[model samples]
Target: MKKILSFFSYVFHPMFISVYAVLLYFFLTDRYHSYQELFLIMIQIIILTILIPISMFYFLMTLGKANSLMLSEITQRKIPLAINAFLLYILITQSIREEVIPELYFFFFGALASTIITFLLIFVNLKASIHMIGISSITIFIIGFSLHTQVNHIYLVATFLLLTGIVATSRLSMKAHDGKELIAGFLVGVLPQIGLLSFWL
Candidate 1:
């Protein structure tokens, strides 16, 4: 039902996608050799991409800058997207500077690229579906990771792709986006990751 669809949409929110992507990368690559390391990395990523953003959203809502947690209005999206893009950039740069998780540099860069494009498109009067963008970014990153590692992750890739469809449907069912916005979101999420993967690979 509509409630179920709304639940799914909330469950797979774009704000959490960045953290999910990095966690997926770590597990897929078997880079989490120890609990301590994994804990540290997860804490860092969650704080940067998830916790801070949540707090900011609450703050924005208090200030009347954002009308909803969803930021469903086009005008409400610009500042939040800009802030997220900036935070993502900082996350990527700091990871590089610290020489931590070098394998994921391109992945984070792709995420940053996606965020940048999404923010820019807001200026063009396009309110692309961030939901679609979030899912697409991870799906594309998984594909690129499989290729770079010369490992077959077709099942995982397919699973993420399937999730993409579910996410798209959820967004549509919730009346969060039209077809054009959905398509734009998917492309914005995918293309940058592909471009970055090619350069890094």
Candidate 2:
């Protein structure tokens, strides 16, 4: 369940949304697209997409450390504002053309949700949580498919939220996170993503 949730979250995060949205736009305009065109585009995104976010995620993590979002600034409210910059990068770039997934908004929510799950797990043991989230993501996806909830990303998002709750609770029960630190972690993960949902703007 955890793994499936993570997969859908990763697959549908904001960055991925840009890629998928572009693909959708292309299909709407082209009206007669082919499978080969689709494959080539996804290949382009999959390879290059990882490069940008890896660096950005690291930078944010380091900033998180320095700001004490991890172990330092619990009271100061200095949660490494770099995540905002990362989201800005996603909003702008994830939708680049030659796009395979083409429907960028879908990609946006997927990547955004996935990223959220990743950040939350950071407070715990990332290696273990990631494996759980990823596997759970796929399982839930199948369940969602079976249930016929494809129009909205609701199934995956719901799974993501529930699993995140579990992980957060686990951390709390383990005494790995104090109240302030837990809030900081959530702020670090969520605030910036909420900031980047430019559709409202």
Candidate 3:
């Protein structure tokens, strides 16, 4: 359960999910859904998803733990933002290839917007809480819907209100987040999802 939860969490991550969405779109519309192609792409997606975040997190950890002036406490804000932006930029650029349709642009844009929103919410609160969790769902719905091509826009949108509530209860039990911070984090998670959905649907 722990591993499953972690995997799900990572899968929903804006950066990772963006990659999945791109790959899904590529395979879905290519008119070439051979098992061979899907297998190849699935490997590519898994590799990129695991590799990118692991690399970035390692760099961040090294810098932060090195106790270097580069990761100085005073400059923590600058570093996280800079690192996040760079990671986001690289991820989106790689995911939305030139060969793909322009609608892919909406997906990337959703990523950007979500990153911005999440950072802002994080600044507002350090901990995740029920409200933050709920906001994330709402955000996811909005982003998904924004894409304008989502197969089940309504279902995705509804997940916000429904899943958010359940997640909120779970968080409460785990004591992972306080109310205010949780709400903020939820919004942060959700806003990008909404942006992404809008890009598609």
Candidate 4:
């Protein structure tokens, strides 16, 4: 049981959420994007969102500024979140332009807003569940994508809803977050996505 819970935590870690969102966006959209274009976009996402963050994490770990990938401490979250926000800003402004792919563009925009909010909460010594934030943000984005594209992605939505509960439980079991932090993370994750729906959806 412990191993399984830990597995979900790592599998749904915040660092990989952007890649998941982009993959899902491509999966569900009927729009035609060339294989080369999709491959390049994916490569960009992997480099910026995953590879860069992992490298930064190792650097911070070497400096004794971060101990783990989970970033279990509020103090540890500051730098990573700030870097993530900057990366997301670059992704939206330079790579995924709104005119090119409005859905993904707005998705990153919402993610940036959520990252900034989470970063701000750290000053007050509040540690919301970043796991919850990641899962919830992607879940709501999936929901919004379904509505906007008029695709019957009910099964996908249901799967993520289930994953959301599993992730919340996983965090609780790991003692990484209390109920309030999880709820706060959920709100922080969803509100921006919901608010930005008008621009794309």
Best-performing candidate as measured by lDDT: 4
Q: State how far residue 119 of model 1 sits from its true place (Å).
A: 1.4
Per-residue CA lDDT of model 4 for 1-201, tens digit only, reads 978988999999988898899889888998998889889999999999999999999999999999998898789999999999999999999999999999999988998999999999998888988899899999999999889889889999999999999999999999999999999999999899899999998
Give the range where candidate 3 is weakest over 10 consecutive residues by summed lDDT: 66-75
In model 1, the worst 10-residue window by lDDT is: 95-104
Better of 1 and 3 by TM-score: 1
Instruction: Give each model's whole-structure lDDT.
Output: 0.82, 0.43, 0.50, 0.93
Give the top-scoring candidate (TM-score): 4
Model 3, 74-112: lDDT tens per residue? 224344545555655664577545355445555555445
TM-score, predicted candidate 4 vs. hidden true structure: 0.98
The local lDDT score (0 to 100) that residue 198 gets in candidate 1 is 73
Separate clash counts for every candidate: 0, 45, 40, 0
Off by over 4 Å in 2: 1-45, 48-91, 94-154, 170-178, 192-201
* lDDT per residue (tens digit) for residues 90-196 in model 1: 88777433266655677778778888888889889998888888889889888887887788999999999989999899999988899999999999988888888
TM-score of each: 0.92, 0.35, 0.55, 0.98
| RMSD (Å) per prediction | 1.8, 9.7, 6.2, 0.8
* lDDT for position 191 in model 3: 60
